[model samples]
Target: MDDTDQIVLSVDGLQVLIDVLTADGYRVIGPTVREKAIVYDDVASVADLPRGWTDEQDGGRYRLVRRDDSALFGFAVGASSWKQFLHRPVVKLWRARRSKNSWQVVPEVPPVERLAFIGVRACELEAIKLQDQVLLEGEHPDSHYQARRDNVFVVAVNCAVAGGTCFCVSMSTGPKAESGYDLALTEISDGEEGTVFVAEAGSGRGRSLLAKLPHRPASAADRQSAKAVSERTAASMGREMRSDDLHELLHRNLDHPHWDAVAQRCLTCGNCTMVCPTCFCTTVEDASDLTGKEASRTRRWDSCFTIDFSYLHGGSVRTSGGARYRQWLTHKLATWFDQFGTSGCVGCGRCITWCPVGIDITAEVEAIRDSEAD
Candidate 1:
């Protein structure tokens, strides 16, 4: 919001800029050409990006296909989420080393990595904000998550093309970035002459990076084009959420019979929650050495779909699949606002597209709403 000034960089030039950031002691992470989807990974240059690559996705299906356009990052997210970087899949808390007669326990602190995450979507940015509340701002803070999050710089990218599964528009979390990013970029590939990116700085660090890049003064036309691109993405969303007041709708429909019907189709495979960028449930484990002299503790991601997630002193609270699924959906769309002051969903549609049975959250919500209407 400081100024409209921006530097235009060609696709190749953008890669060079990342190299420069790396040379200057910043670890650069961006979307790269993976086996089939555009995945976030370490990249040293532009060639590391998924150039001329796109994806075709449907319920429980996704495939990488070639595109005629020479556009990098023309696809949606891969299986990996920002959660892998911020909240690690697995972490060791302590290690047990043996002395002559007794064992000594050593605490393992998380290594803070100065990371620059490039090409983060607006929805993912919001997801990070949600996690920030849980991991950093919560009552009991996670020292490990705090270290990684504090040392990180975010480079957000506006979606140029909406995936078949994307519904960020209805969620109101994306199509364009609002905040929580150091830099935001709108990739312009539909121009008459060449490719260019319109960059905006969200912080002083971002402004400094822009100052070092080879860029030109942005014109009013560039700003207009960026706006148009975001508008198109909003219009092209594959799914739509009808409940403008999502919280009220979710609470009202809790007892709706539709929950039972959907539970039949749901495998409870936990794929939806696992791939979700904002789902932050976790469980801890303890291990001991063979001699029983040393013990270590580890933490890993957990899902509500799992029966043990709700387990407490007596027994599992959510015993049935329907109950657990309902808990997850209600918490994500309804109660999450009260808990985190934001909707748990980014509307990336990953849950719908990645579910083993292709269970569409939007369709389910509509069904419940329609039943109530009748």
Candidate 2:
């Protein structure tokens, strides 16, 4: 967060930084063009990144576009979030095997994934913090999340380009990373001077890594240029959400007509919950071999939109699409505050851009507000 340790790195130096992290036994995870979309995957070098590409995103739409400038972190968030790596979509809990007519239960060995997350956005960082609160700070902590989170290196990116659905500024989360990063970089494209990055060390590990990379001390001009990038991104935010009094607003609007309207367009495909970085709901599945000698239990991500998600002995609590949609929205904007002292929505807009029917959360909330005001 401090500028005292700020340094400058050329595009080549950025590659060196990646090599250093990889040499230090970290799986270098970053953004790359895959299937025509910039997605997070294993990066072998700097060339693997989507350098000259950005994305055009809106409700029910996402398309990759080439940028005039070859900026690596120019695009907004993709459909894939950090959740797929940290809170795995599916995990085997334990396996039961029959041995000598007695079942032997054996726990699955935890994976040793020392990940180095590169190009992490500010809202993504905040979402990670929120997950930490739920998965680590809670009474019954998730061992899988705890194990995967240990010793993970975070390299955050200061946004220079805002996507069409980005509302992190309105949510008070991004365009700039304030905390939760080992190293933060702001990529500045200079016409003749070429592209350079203003890097700052946010942790001791970051400071150590920066020391190894080839870089010069950032001048006052460098710092100002970096600050300008954040300013530009903040002003370019594509959407705005009224974060004030959302808990009480949604709390009182439980029976509002907006839910039914949204439900009409909702497919309940669970795309939003899957892309949500903070959604932690999951369900377990038990499997057995044909011989019935071996059995296993696996945990996979689940969504509130599914009727079975609220299944009880007699029937599912939320049978209608309206009820399920209300549960998803209200819990995100209302009960999340009661449960965890913070809004569940990070305003990253993944839910908006990836929805099959283009159901926008901000618009849905605004509809209720407008109706109540009328």
Consecutive 10-residue window with the lowest summed lDDT within model 2: 189-198
Cα lDDT, all candidates: 0.84, 0.92
lDDT by residue for model 1 (1-374), tens: 85465656666667767877788777899988666677889988878878778777677888889988877767777767888998999989899877897778898989978888988999899889889888889788998898899888888889888888888888888879989898888888747747788888898988888787877777888888888989998888877786577899889888888888989998989999999999999999999878877889999998999988889998999988888889889889998888877788888888987898999888888888888789
Model 2 ranges off by over 4 Å: none
Show where candidate 1 strays beyond 4 Å.
96-105, 190-193
Candidate 2 per-residue C-alpha lDDT over 38-119 given as tens digits, one digit per residue, 9 for 90 to 100: 7999998989999899999999999999999888888999999998999999999999999987999999977888999999
Which predicted model would earn the best lDDT?
A: 2
Name the lDDT value of residue 317 in candidate 2.
Answer: 97
Q: What's the TM-score of each model vs. the native?
A: 0.94, 0.98
User: Count of backbone clashes for each model?
Assistant: 0, 0
lDDT of 2 at 265: 92
